[model samples]
Target: MTGTDGLVVGEEVPEFSAPLVAPDADREERSLSELLSDGPVLFCFYTADFSPDCIEEWCSFRDFDWFASTSDVQVVGISKSRSWIHQQFIDYLDLQFPLFSDRDLTIAEAFDVRYRVFGLFERSKRSCFLIDEDRTVRYKWVGQHWLDPTRDVPPVTEIFEGVRNELGAPETETFGFDAAMTD
Candidate 1:
């Protein structure tokens, strides 16, 4: 069930699909169940691509060591940006994770994170969710305001800890940002 404010911990995320931009810049249609099949998934919903805060947030994810170390949990980002924009953002930041293009905000709306900025522009609130293979949300954090540095993104360390605690420790070593660069 959804919380009064939005999706809450323990609720099963609704099924959804979107165009995905892989780190290699390949684009394809991906569904939530398909993603969960690999393992737990972290869905980070940001406003748009290339904005200063967005750049910083994604860079932080790119630099976080835990993400690079883990193979059992997939970290994916979503936003209202188009597939091409997502590709550009990934290439520009050299992001190691896949991103979803929710151009119509359908995914955000399903998660109840869609909101209007200044009562004008429709955008997804900065939010993050850790959903297990069973599709149950284990952790959820939603930002309170737009452009508020204090609330724009959830703490990376906290997300790391949540993933560890919810999905168990990483089972295998994998390439991180540095490895991605050399390849």
Candidate 2:
């Protein structure tokens, strides 16, 4: 099968590089392998940059504090949108994470999240993958349309909890105030 078919858990992220728009709007090239050099990565592939659902999803990631709670997990957004569009999204949202331009769809295809409808509309599916420092897939989720028959992507807190648990770390209620009960 071609890369379009996607990869499964335990698979190594493909050796691929692409242009990314940093939070500062600086353009740079990054390889999946190179990112692994730092630590585990959360590769979040979404349909379109400015789409409402995508905005909501990513903004949640932006507001979530779990990434800071973990020492080495890097989050990256991927889409077929151009670098300028990615830059615009970052600026508009004041996002803290970097977004990469999957212009060729190579990264999406390798992750098996590329979706094309009737040879017309082509984009990456709303998917998330947690790849460890060794480049092995740790967790993954592919989303369906949020309207009907929703695929129900896991909440940020759940993703954080899972990742933290796997890393052998203590868990905290991400958004809940356990302290309120003690008051």
Candidate 3:
């Protein structure tokens, strides 16, 4: 099926940033400018941290930890959840990735992913965007819990292969990364 770029292949990513959902006392902020400034970025937008679908999606990624290790991609889970709540969810689920709290819905708005889901309450849609090295969206996917995140998108292995084919790898390297090296 056709993806979010509409009909275009390469287009500038929608700009965005918001407060982090991590529960650390120091706290921090997330900026699309800052994130894409270094290199490729993958933004995974979920309704909330603890929802059944969100939980399953995160667990799928967690189960395949290698997605992060071998690819030149930066995976971030985004939601409108509060930082403290996000911390609890992460801790309870033992998620190793970083999640941002777009409490104000600024980032989601910019990305055009925030909207009213239940006809009464506005929530984040389950969407994913692949921003390339130049901060342009290369691919996009969005789902409203009709499918399973565990099977819908092949594990990080396929993602790595697709990305490597889309973007050239170093000449000396024989393969993409096999595990995520994050902080």
Better candidate by lDDT, 1 or 2? 1
- How well is each residue in 1-183 modelled by candidate 2, as lDDT tens digits? 153434687888878899988998889998888888988888888766887877888778877756544455788889888999999999998887888898888888888777665446667767778899888888876665544211334378667666665555534433332445313
Candidate 1 local lDDT, 58-176, one digit each (tens):
98888876675667778999999999999889999888899999998889888888777656788778888998988899988777653542247778877766766776654344334
Best by TM-score: 1
For residue 105, what is the lDDT in candidate 1? 84
Estimate candidate 2's RMSD in Å: 3.8
lDDT of prediction 2: 0.74
Quote model 1's TM-score: 0.87
Candidate No. with top lDDT: 1
lDDT scores in order: 0.80, 0.74, 0.64
- Using TM-score as the yardstick, the better of models 1 and 3 is 1
In terms of lDDT, model 1 sits at: 0.80
Which consecutive 10 residues in model 2 have the weakest lDDT in total? 145-154
* C-alpha root-mean-square deviation, each candidate: 5.0, 3.8, 5.5
